[model samples]
Target: MIKFAFCYEHDDTLSFVKNEVQNCLRQREIEISVLCCHNACELAQRAHSGCPDILFCDLEQDDATLRSAIMNVKRANNRLICVSTAASHSAHAEDILLEPLYRMPALNRKHLWRYAALAYEKILDEPASFTYYVRPSYLRVPVHEIRYFASEGRRTHIISADCRDTFYQKLDVVEDLMRHKNCRFMRIHKSYLVNASFIAGFSRDYVLLTTGERLRISKYEYYQMLTNQLKSLKNTKLRYHPSYSEW
Candidate 1:
């Protein structure tokens, strides 16, 4: 069943999102369960029983609180679909619905329903698309290109294979995804979430990545991964794990 959580600033706003979600679910005959939160802090308790497939929050809530809630959803393995007035401002969300309706300052029912249906369609039919999630800066590099992750002050940098395009993503989210045992990602450092298919060699404390970048590996995690999780990645056809080392 698809589950959803809605956190809004007002009752009318909550009603609008709910009505839209229900209308879409009913038409598709999809079973769904829902929980509602009036503010960001209230989200924690509502989502405690189980994670939602989507979460919607208003920008009027405190920024710190909203960010906390977003982080919580990510940590809980939940994908977010936000509803807000400013699409540009809420660029962080995976999906955003901007409503021009001022009557009750609520989301447009048709738009909201269409968005939810589309989300469900994507999740069910295109789960493999997540592999391309590497940031745009890294896209220019060859897929087999190995890289380094290092931290400076407060940010994490993706040192390129050629030591040039050192793009960065915050360390927090990277660290969170690393903790999942079933997740295909492995953490070579506090700042990196390396895809297992990228590793070319391993010896003692270091792993030689396909990008030819050598990175330190936690001894415990290295052993655990090698013995348990690494094979599943290799068996999958997600990426053509090229046999040639110098691709």
Candidate 2:
């Protein structure tokens, strides 16, 4: 069974996306629980109690409002995978999924189903480690060890804290592969795929990687990154660590 919760301001758009989502899930014979929220407060309450596996949010709202609502939901359900219905170009965050709502003509029912399936697969078959075959060697990389990936012509560079390797693969293909395995890799640019954990800061033109590399980002990407950062910071306080004491 898959549970979904939606937060949207416009009722018509909400109905459209929800119907698409429900129809696809039904085809797969998956039982679903749909919770509709009109405001951030309602969304937060549902998140706290229902803890839906997937959260779909409308990005048409004001930045401040969306940020607040996203933060509230994250606080309640840290594990929830959020999908956005706007800002198509930004791969700013790891947890929040971005799907262009305006491009509904291009994104048909099949695309929506694929998106839902991807989210479902992440929840069901998340892997702790990912293996990639570098040209001369095979590396079994831990999901947490990856920092980012950069595409160079026909090769892709795997950048991490300990090592960097180049492999023959396209950025999009690599993105899908990692995503299927539940790795938090966001495509910040056409040539760059970034790990959300390594994003130090970002501006309208660029994203500052933790390693001091500034990667170019589109305007939409910047907005998405900003929203993601806000949600992450808000939920940081709720994250627990066994090694650290509360005091």
Candidate 3:
């Protein structure tokens, strides 16, 4: 079962996205849980309990709710996928929908539900795919593409070597998917959760990724990562590139 939660200010928008998205998903036999939140803190609390798979919101949610919700989501799930209905000043959450409240088309619940299901289907089909729940919807993304997720203040960003595509997802969703896929993602820093496959080499204090991204490797788990990496490669048919040093 794929669970979902939606946090939005307006009742109408909430109804529209959830109805459309969830219904579409049902035909495929996916289960979802939807919640409507009026306060940011309330939503944050939900995230802390266990971040949902997807989080769709009106970025224009009252300043206080927006701020608190953003913070809560980051603390709980940094890779969460967010679909914004308004242009939010919130640094971490990005704008997904193009138009503002009045200018946007009427919220279509059916459409949202179908998209939700389609997204899930994609996840189930991909070997590297994982699932997460938003309040009213569920989301899935490829894990290998993610370099790391970091939080700053109340905002968080999904960092990847391909700066051209900074895919945004609710932090909670990221955590959920991480658990389901059983991938090698580690919360190395308070602000960072990294994919182990990207790691090229490591020492007690830091890790070097093939992408050339240097990540802090805590002394507590550095050796464990080395062991895990070795095991990860044991079953694979690995071949060295010409540039790879022959050890």
Q: Return the TM-score for each candidate structure.
A: 0.44, 0.46, 0.41
Of 2 and 3, which scores higher on TM-score?
A: 2
Off by over 4 Å in 2: 88-110, 128-247
How many clashing residue pairs are found in candidate 1? Answer: 2
* lDDT (Cα, tens digit) per residue for candidate 3, span 8-127: 666776676777667676654566667667558668766666776556666554475565566566546544455544344443333322111121223455436534643454334444
lDDT of 1 by residue, 16-127 (tens): 8887888777765667788888876788777777877666666644376766765676667634444454433434442332211111144577557645654553334322
Question: Per-prediction RMSD in angstroms?
Answer: 13.8, 12.9, 13.7
Arrange candidates by TM-score, highest first: which order? 2, 1, 3
Per-candidate local distance difference test: 0.54, 0.64, 0.54
Q: Which candidate model has the greater TM-score, 1 or 2?
A: 2
> Once model 3 is optimally superposed onto the true structure by TM-score, how far is the C-alpha of residue 186 displaced, in angstroms?
29
**Looking at candidate 3, what is the lDDT of residue 97?**
26
TM-score of model 3 vs. true structure: 0.41
Per-residue alpha-carbon lDDT of model 2 for 32-111, expressed as tens digits? Answer: 88998877778766666767777777554445655666666556656566666445555345224322122122335665
Query: Which candidate number would show the highest TM-score if scored against the true structure?
Result: 2
Error of 1 at 165 (Å): 42
Candidate 3 has its poorest 10 consecutive residues by lDDT at 238-247
